[model samples]
Target: MKKSLLFLFGLFSLWSFALINFKGVPVFSIVEAQQKTQPLTGKKVKTEKPVTIKRNAVTTVLPVAQYPLPKGSQWSYLDNGSDQGATGWNQLTFDNSAWAAGAAPLGYGDPVATTISYGPSSTNKYITSYFSRDIQIDLNTIGDEVEFGLRRDDGAIVYVNGVEVFRNNMPAGTVNYLTNSASIVDGADEKRYFTTYLPKSVFQNGVNRVSVEIHNRDQTSSDISFDMYIRDKAPDYVCVEDHIACFTSIAPTSQTPVMIIPQEHRFQMLFKQGTAYMDGSGTVPGNHDFTGYIPSVGATSSALGHLSVNHENNPGGVSIVDIALNQDPANPLWVVNNSRKVDFSNTALVKTERNCSGGVTPWGTIITAEEATTSGDSNGDGYQDVGWLVEINPATASVVNYGNGTHEKLWAMGRMNHENIVVSADGVTAYYGEDGGTHCTYKFVANTPNNFSSGTLYVLKMDLALSNDEPSSATATWVQVPNTTQAERNNVTTAAAALGGTNFNGVEDCEISPIDGKIYFASKGKNRVYRFKDNGTTVSEFETFVGGKSYPITTANGVVTENWADGNDNLAFDDHGNLWVVQDGGLNYIWVVRPNHTQSDPKVMIHSSMPAGSEPTGLTFTPDYKYGFFSVQHPSGSNQAQPDATQSNVIFNASAALVFSNKDFLGQQQNLSTNPVVALNSEIQVYPNPTKGLVTLSLNEEADKNLKIEVYDFLGRKVYAKETQTTGINQKETIDLSGFKGEQLVIIQVETGDTKQIYKVLKKDN
Candidate 1:
């Protein structure tokens, strides 16, 4: 499945003023003052020997302890000079009585409370350390949730009741004492806090053992820090399964063109989200040259009374534009007018980079994401830029500043290679996905609805081992991470890794179901889309909806003929509960899957297709479901655009905005008598007459009835014959003359009962 945001804080230190707050949950401290503290004392469990408790000198700080520290939340340690062979070190039954007892803040570097448990030993170089402790679990009085506050200088893996639960700053796969940690943890001077949450499912009726193994960056590492605190509270909400969706089977249609954007029209729209502001300073109202573009989001409706399009450009900057659209339901087409560029560069988006795909907020705004985690200091903010969720006000055509910096970065939402952001109907809880390998899914809970300025971010950790099945999973846990400032926010990825967030295969676009309130997200690299249940505070019921190795298909020359789609990028939901998915890879196709579709009655359909070398992006619908907007990006140049003879007056290319009328998408047709063809010969036309192998025959709606088509060589040999129905006016049918060798002329005949006609055409060799 996919994973989800939060900010950064200064390194973990004993400074009294360094205290931070989340809603009312104070940042747990290992060096709180006033001496109003207790030792690790609680119901003792079975061990070889009694547990030893240590008391250190306490400092006089402030009254910030909102929740009393849990008993036995501290740990005892042992330094590993070399590889400690596989043993029961993580189990409650493991005999660690011989280990030394020391209060937390146990390491050589940084400010500590009691003792330096390891390191600073020049000769006896220690590379890894071990820690274990036991905490009482009173099922009757304890809550269903547990939160942990940890500080590790390098990396560590945590366990509860002998079960391995979380790992941070560590490599994947089996790890041992000799195994070195991942990259050096980010920060200077002090250990940083890495927080996470665990459900009551990890606990039992009695005493549970908490164990940890801390690994150093290298043998010469000067510091190694480790500390933890735990508390239990009732879960805010629970998830129950309602409906599970599966990727519906779809048949790819050939050359069924919808719309096209030519290279000439690219300048009309802005570049991708971040690329527009590349030079650093450009007035919003000024017109400029544009080469290529990517569309990220599209919104339209009568309530909004206009159309909004998002440009997803990385090298320049992202932008949104407001346009007035005129559509005729009877004609099944629309036109763009009164286009106005949204001022993203002048406002908060001046620093946006790789502003990729995003989702629309319920409050009639767009939540554009900066796909780059490390955008250089674009705004000269001292801090490196990019990697943020920016809110845009479509109505005013500007960034939405909620007292934060321009283009509210939602710094409280943490930083990562953000792919998409979907807010809950309540507007307080938001779900996001990261677009990189081995990333985590996250959720942010605001202090109040529609006010995301301050909130708590949590990373999702699933118990996948509990069930081997890939899809239909219903269990996962959320761990809170710090998100108080921009710098702190930038450390979210590292914090989430430490919190044991599940590794996903490049999580992308996330959307919430209005019918069921479930959140759906895509793992593009894995070729699967997944959904989960969110209860505002905590989320559960994570499972894959569809797409995997099981759905087999192949792409040749920008065309896919299979009944499945891969590389699912953006997603949109129409009022009818139909999910429209936009593909990213070469075979740019838009697939529509019905919510209640089943195997016996498959309801998946190919809604549209982008031209060769392009992908359909920014799929969205108006509030009234009357019109849907999308963009076709990056059409290849050397190759011919090769318009579908079936579509009328369409140009598909880079950074082009297009729309589909709800009626046209539903296969509805206008009154045939209103626009009829009197003579078949006069209404029919052939394109590129002297063609190589392929040629198109465009027919008007009068040819809607079954017609017999035949082709003959110069020698009077019948080469081909077929009967088919015309879909609409200007319907195109491609005929291949490749098999007719040594032929310079061919006879083509069309016959439908009383109407029969023959025409001579020239065939050329490649």
Candidate 2:
């Protein structure tokens, strides 16, 4: 999510003149299409071959498929938080409503917030603060061209060899609009470059400090969300065929490298019907049941559905906290009846995060974040409190908490609403999303990094590009905090500062294209998607896609965008050069957006939607690309007493599991559809996909002389690239894939007038 294209009006308010009429799928039926095909007036329908434009211009349009689900093949419904029992449980309740109950030592159950913070984040005594740290990497493996990105609210800064790569410092408050809330390092903001280049030598063998600074104005006080990590591979490092999918049934036969969600570590994902469930159980691949508590309208599979609960953000019946928010056992995970059986009677508990969503670690573990501070007492009543980041190990089936500095600090981070984690290509820096009306995105730079305790944290900020003169969209800059104890860490929390704050739609899930170091994110609050390039600077600018609700849509400028509303959760690119977007199950439907990245005027080539209740969560492509996996966690528990099935669609209405093909989104490969029609012909094509090294093709074959080779994004915007000579036929050419990331697309178009052709290619394992 980026900044709003509108300017500000009042102080606590900014007003956009007109609601720009921005835009907008479906299934099939044999009886439907045939009826239309049947000649109403059989007048020998003259078949028209028309003109033979032998794919004159081959344009490669990456095909999108439904995000895969975890193909656990057989996941036993566990009840315990350990690895042992995987069966039924008698109605059981701990019979306690106290805060941080149980005999466990309260807090995040980790080292107290002494002095050091996660990353190099600074803390403000008055209201804001910062804490910073460093992560040393081997530049040898990570070429000098290493690049990544960060997401923050008001501002941020990333440096390599002390050379600034990213920076931004927006205000506080919050922006709900997607385009207005997201900030990438390139294009949009001068200080933030999307594709920043860091030479291999930039990182010495020993230690390197990755510092961060944040400011907090009076409004909501101060707190920063920052993540720092490093990876040696590019965004496309995981080839389409190699990158595991969103859903399938993988856990049972998961060949995809594993990551653990340590015991006690809070972890949750939308499975079916947008229902939320947590695995409070010890570890993964265990005997003890990981199935813990489920908060919903009710906790039954068929009978009463998991309707709603009155939580902080979710009022009425609609739910918000589907996933757990913390990892400490002291917190009661007791809840239930949302899975296969409809029974809120038995009070089963699970783990959770601190508002910040949990993330899968490179080591195959799940890291749950607790958005609370060390001293707990977010209201500042002076009561002992707790906040920290916890880790859940799948192998060991255990959980550990990494507490925060202060309660207000934890609460300021947005009270257990942590939404995303964008890890670095090498595991040096990690970007975080603070989902809230007055929250900012942040980064965590681990000290020993992989070992934890070392590094700094930085906030996200962007310049107001659309509003030149207005201070709201001022120069793109990323403010820095020497330590987490600084005086101002909420600098970017302003509606204007953080490009409209976290309003219309706040940043939910963020991902980067390893190939070009481009960043993409979903703004659930806004129902939009955005892009950011890496050019070396604080991230602020973002390209966008206004994918309409459940429909294939294109921008007036010709570029295609993805769409969603409260369309929360994950994002990823497949080996086929396609971008897959996942929405919250409860959002009413499933949508897949396919944009012709190679087209000059790219349009959404495909769009598909499914019925309600199919709550989709987590996504992964199998290593073989033959299968995919995602988690459709069934709903559980109800605020009221237990309700039987006759009541309503209850929890099951929010539960589901899905698995579709690579072309599922386009309805091309899939046979079933709510409205499947011979969709309009797309202006895209590609070749030698899953190639070992080079790939080539042309936009139009009519050109007798030359073809221009370039790479574009979903919005049809070209990024840093070069041209090459094609063979006599439409300028045949080859590009070195050694420098590129994962399976990506390269466009070759004819220079001869308006002639064009498109081709799709894949760069993969040799």
Candidate 3:
């Protein structure tokens, strides 16, 4: 049962991380266009894209309900010092004409609301602050009870119409300027609202004034906070978690992102790009110009990890960083420690330019792809320097230069504006996509398993005609290019076209599924994810797995229309076999397709969204499947810093990688306490694990009446599928692998109503 994908509202509780969606902006708009308003620097700006509305297209929008503050509740605040405190300060007649004014939540230590003119520092800060606001209310149209939704630090006392209505975290009898709060408040708890109710009789008919005195727990406290609102009644309540992901500035040097590490009671600056402070110690400063961060762990159990970041500048390169978790005693929170840059110059890597999205091998190395088709050849090796896949060893910080004296370019891969590469689980086969207007999808089969230096490259020539209006598939044949070296042909694009290679529209990232062992690649121009079936030597089946040219477009006037799903790039998969795709094309969305999803049932969900003009890239998941990492790249530069009242406090379009826990997207909270585990049943067995032709499937228990069997090749294409009644109990059946007689791996899946099982079968002979 497949379901069409729709843009889903982020309905998750606010943890340390907050989700932000900056929709309908393009990355290139930053340089060419400008909003007449203040500087954005990397913020959202709405753009009008030409859309042809189809009467039949219906956009599915998930409505989110929020209990927000009513209009005109913002307060004006003044810092109260020991010298200025007076007995009548809480009264409306108090002379406070010289006090400062700002929007509420007037507090320190949070970026979400307007800060009061006071202490983030001990010197310029005051221990207590006084706030007052006058709101006009009609007594005839009001409820009996008034609810004050308040956020404060340490303690606060509220007075309405010169009467003490409520006091929280304050001493019982007497509260003075010098008195401290009864308890200390730290972290996000400071932003929590402590609701206090009072009778409507306490308010006047018109121009009623409310005052609040906020006192810190102590003078030496690191932060102070306060915010509140008055309502006739508590708002229509709903536990809708619309915002769950946190945000950072587009450029990290300006403001580091604050993240709450999963399973830990703390916050940390996970890592920042495009900054001068190189290492976590702040002692060494290397090029802070790194982007497209891909996190890698050393082993299955290690929290300490390494990051391979792509430098997107034209003269760009890749930087490797070593990162570890540290608990800072000052805050008793987890922070990133000793982030050292792994040097790669001494190796054959003299230069790597315009490095963008790449892949991580099963062997634990980073394959950084250069997203260039034409940059004058820099290596003096005849071929251009920018269209190659440069593999780097994270442990040793060495580039696999193939000993050609320069970081060896895999010229045989036939790159034309190469986007990214994905290797099959079998390791001998690799798939890559081209990010060009008329590019072709290609693959390479290594002569030896896991060895890419020597391989036969083939371009896919579809057996069926292609169209942009609809999703299509064909049994494609591989056309092997003769000259495998750049020195021989000098132009891989021409070499690929010389074969019968069919053209695709803007092929982006090619992702090999860990679950189905098939290849899924995104094409921006075509607006579809193409699925392929790869045996060791060639791609046999090619088709659109999900997505098409026309998708439901949301208009500015909130109208549903038909539009293109433009900018589909950077594909990833979680352990659950859900394909998570990010857009580079201007849609600014992160979409997910479930494992059993079909083309008709577009069960794709818009998992994450960003502000307009920012494209999401480098979507990855940790080996433990605990956190998913992605980045918002090259946002609009106008109005990037000002607080958008509608957005989360942490919302910004800074070029930063965001980390979200698996549970945040999966909507299963208990999984947070435990690591995700993939358990295979030992009860089902496939004999001749590395079978040459045929394999026997045996189940320890009785087979259900109707059994479903499926076989997928390395490229994730279904080669064989059957639904049949099996012998009643402990039945055995033989699956013929003779058709797939090659040195490649095939995934066999058996599903019953109650149980499902998967097996990896290696076909080794004729």
Candidate 4:
């Protein structure tokens, strides 16, 4: 005969049973156990396999509970500056009825709910302050571990149930009331919270006493602060995939449009405003605007790079973040390795303001545009120097030095309400637009290739008058502007108008088509995106590429008809020549226009709609085109949380930077069939023409034989040569041109078996 022994665990009673013989020996079974559902909670409980155990064996484990000590909780503190020594004042049995009670955080100097006395004199303040709180705990309902969130200045020591549990900033060995902190606490570290974990065994079954002693670095320390909270050591958020629709028919009015994406894609938040940096600096700034991604040198992984994010404020700042991909294959995630604020005060410009959209140079540097002009001249450079383009080294989070004791503001770029700038592949020409009410599109040609210190500025002058309300076309010439003097550069808008420069209403962004090498810019006030073919001196075939007309948008719900509203702001291109338009006005939608889109029959799709009271800005892609980054600027505080259920309690309601990509799109080569620049013969291609320091040679799949690449300068002098076997796919070979000087023409020859191709490339000095 056999007897059954049963056991139930915790509040969510899970049942398990074992069979025992009459002689008291347990019998194990391998049969599958069934699951039972609790009617009250509607939660399923899974049973474990029957095992051999004692007849009266029992086990208890409970789920983690909510935080026990919240901010501003009342605490009994002693601030009389007397040494309590090792007298059992921290024990539960100790009498503390005479101690003064106050709501935390309680200290001096910084903002606090309750301020405590700092002792006799300002020069001779007290060294330590004592704080204690009582909390009840149940052994059967508590978790295995607890975490303490402590905010202290200088140092602190914590005790649980009259036993030492953690020490921070204090010296090693026996600690007493006279102990001093290891170092001084200053700046942002004073307000930062430090966390520590301890086993729940330190707590008691009934009432538990928690005591903490905060010590200053020295007796004369100017400031002191203390606050603490306790919670179970379990993560509040459980990561889950957000499965949203690919498209929605509802427009954003009272609330933000629901984020929809392709079924295979995933969206993730990389950084949020007000998050503390890993280096103990202040939290990330708000009003996130321009986001630029710079891939690390020689980085084999597509996800390893640096991000330069601009804060659009009165005194603007740029934050540089070093990021990498996590190792989890099932759930790939991007992690921030380090982050800090870019130091612009060390430069001659002192500080930047209203940093809007920017561009990345081919030689690895970021150029941030100052979108506003100010009357104050911090640099005293005869004219207001706040509206020039500034360059930065994202890797070091510092402004580039010109080696002349000055810093990275390009004075030659002229002063205006700059919206965005785009550099050509050759690194010689740059196009930017003015975002004022009546402004003109401008161009810059560097005198020394990649060096933008001194450049010639020009404004667009169209031969035919272009219509602002309907589809129109025209030819234009770049008229040279008198930008040599500070006074002339200060008033470029007025001078350009005098020279008959075509006035565009709110020209917001400029981008070069990677497929056909054409220039495209968006006029926000006119609601049109105009494209132009750049010939050496003049532009031809200038016409409206998108907007200024009605188009059909396909969605998962159904086909929807819409017209371009007054919102087209920023523009970016993908590997497939698809244009991604980020909006700052109207419905604040992110629109994607295919390469084959025509004026009569446009192929456009709505990708995303920003949250209420917010506009999407700064959309940039990685080198492999596998990931994209953008910012949601100043979203409504009441907007719904995203991705996870616990996010509702988090701070994503503020501004944030996000990254999105699909697993199927990673590690794929560029599509050469649709790109005219790379599909001439579907064989070999050399770019960027007019090399600065290095040039890349790309070979197609048909080039499977032994490949020979040779570069010759003017007068037929062999400058560089290499021979290797081709992988027959998207194989790239880099040719170094740093040895050459000045601007000169060079011929790059590629021979694969019998097929040979020669490209006339211009090699420019760095």
List the pairs of residues colliding in candidate 4.
Answer: none
Cα lDDT listed for each candidate: 0.57, 0.33, 0.57, 0.71
Model 1 lDDT tens row, 1-766:
1211121232233232322222232433322321223222222321122223322321221121223233222365766464554777778777665455544556675434334445556644577888777666666765567667566768888888678788878899987777888878643313334557677778676767778888888776766777666665322211111111112233454433333322111111222222233223442221111111112243324422444554555443434443443344343333333345555555234556666776666666777777787656666664456777877665555677886444556778877888787788778888888887336788888997887778999988763321122421244668888777776777888888887887776777778876567788877766666777765444554555555422222222333435454677887775545677777773567766666432222345555556566677777655545445666666544334343222433344344655444333222245645533225667677767887778788877554677778876643346788998756686888899887666487767776555666666888876
Q: List ranges where model 4 is wrong by over 4 Å.
A: 1-258, 299-301, 468-472, 644-651, 663-766
lDDT, residue 570, candidate 2: 60
Task: Give the C-alpha lDDT of model 1.
Answer: 0.57
Per-residue CA lDDT of candidate 3, range 355-377, in tens?
77788787777887767755666
Model 2: runs farther than 4 Å from truth? Answer: 1-356, 369-388, 400-416, 465-475, 481-505, 534-537, 546-568, 585-587, 595-602, 605-614, 633-766
Q: Give me the displacement of residue 579 in model 2, in angstroms.
A: 2.6
Worst 10-residue stretch by lDDT in candidate 2? 98-107
Identify the candidate with maximal lDDT. Answer: 4
Candidates 1 and 4 compared by TM-score, better number: 4
CA shift of 423, model 1, Å? 1.3
- Residue 45 lDDT in candidate 3: 24
Each model's RMSD to truth, in Å?
21.4, 29.1, 26.3, 30.8
**lDDT for each residue of candidate 2 in 605-624, tens digit (9 for 90 to 100):** 22223222233444544323
lDDT of predicted model 2? 0.33
Q: In candidate 3, which residue ranges exceed 4 Å CA deviation?
A: 1-269, 279-299, 325-334, 338-350, 375-379, 401-407, 469-473, 536-541, 549-564, 637-653, 662-766
